[model samples]
Target: MYAYQCIYLADVYLCEAGKLLVVPMDGSHWFTMRSVVEKLIERGHELVVVMPEVSWQLGQSLNCTVKSYKTSYTLEDIDRAMKDFAGTHWTVRDDNMVSLWMGSGYNFFELVFSHCRSLFNDKKLVEYLKESSFDAVFVEPFDMCGLIVAKYLSLPSVVFTRAVFCHYLREATQCPNPLSYVPLNFVSSSDVMTFKERVWNHITHFQERLFCHHFFKSVLDFASEVFPEPVTLYDLFSHTSIWLIRTDFVFDYPKPVMPNMVYVGGINCHGGKPLSKATKPGSRTQHGYDPLT
Candidate 1:
């Protein structure tokens, strides 16, 4: 077994001269940017963050430049899109919640088209990159559009995956796609959700597999149309110069590793900031909330 123990996102805030573009998939995980950009500044690099308008507060707090973009769909929007598409077989509970087949809390078709749209949305992101002239693009895994943009620009790209090795990265590295390799029964997270959440996510995982099989071919076609040389999704991901996994190697199973992929450890390592006595969960009376929140 390949065992990696210390998994933390370092908060050194290195500063380099070259511009680095950082984007996240979710608003809650915005701390990754805080830690990374701080490190970049400390090392002397210019830092910029791209995210949805919802995170404007985080942008203000960091005192960094931010470019807001549409990164997600609301639950209402998802329902509307599903209804618009034909040939989709969906089962919603009486409460209207869907099953999360893979425990990521996405519907099967949602996973597929969500990625497909991300792949297609590179044109917009490419324009931004050209305008900004960023040296590197570090993206959260959920921001698949960043991957597409990075590939288009041929810029050095780094993806921060919250989970262990996922299918896309596995395939890119010429390793067996983890989706195909791992048993369907496997649970990647420590806690399980209610049945309502499971029902929706399970269906989503199934849809994702079907979409990858069906829509990826068209993505290849589009790539050929856009580039002088033909490229596939696998080619795009393979072109990624660095893979930043948010995990340690220890708990993961043994597999053939690649040279470009680096185990950057976890997102929790922010150098050494001693947790205050009041910072503990139940000790609210001491520190009055670390204020980082």
Candidate 2:
């Protein structure tokens, strides 16, 4: 019997035209973004993804038309920076649990904002945006800098949360913050933080907020002088509509939320299909053997 080899390929489908461009920050972006894009495409939307070089490479391989932004520093650089500042110092010894101290130094938050601005103002990107028009833009809040671009284009924007929903941002929106009364990571879950982590989280939260305010102030102040918007950039973030949080209703915590603030927990996995039968089970050889003979 002659053995035959066969290969299978899925049809290439162009994402339907007219949704908007999606600007995802990094590989650590919300995992649900891909699913959301697919659903939008199915509903007749074309997606142009603006991503950093690393994300572009990955997104393009997955068939997305990617806009690449160049960055000088690597993830390792940020990691080292964090370790030196917020992380455990090897110089210290004799501790059951190493306590991290808040140090006074160059504001790491401002440094991070500067890095974000560089990506935002990439010349090629600005030119592209000047020519291209998008219907709307979506971004994760942890990756907040995308909002700058959205604001520049005067386009509507939505924020998706990758971590616990931010109470401060919600309060800024005039919505009741569910986590305001509850401590950070205090939701009813197996993954809730231990006592030490909670304490550290609180400490770090204050430090981060202080620097974040300063960072936002400097950026917004400069942008106010330059941009045509009547409201300050910081003010713009407060009034944004439709904040989608990843917390489930099962968490049993609810606050006086604004109509715009929606609990979109696990909405990322919505409308996704599993791998096809042919893509699983049998090995490639089992499906059809290759005979070199």
lDDT of each: 0.55, 0.55
Candidate 2, TM-score vs. the true structure? Answer: 0.61
lDDT (10s digit) by residue, model 2, range 152-228? 77777776665422345645567553233444432232335567655565664565456455435656754564467
- Model 2: residues >4 Å from true position, as ranges? 1-17, 54-60, 82-112, 163-167, 177-211, 215-233, 268-293
Expressed as tens digits, the lDDT of each residue in 1-293 for candidate 1 is 01112234585543326778765554445566467667666656666776554332356555567665453565465445444442232443322222323222334234333543543465675476578877788776543556665676767787766552234566687765333233222344222445655554465456555645443454465556657898766777776777776667765655557876777676666566664576455655565444455
Question: How big is the positional error of residue 172 in model 1, measured in Å on the Cα after superposition?
Answer: 0.4
Error of 1 at 54 (Å): 4.1
TM-score of each: 0.56, 0.61
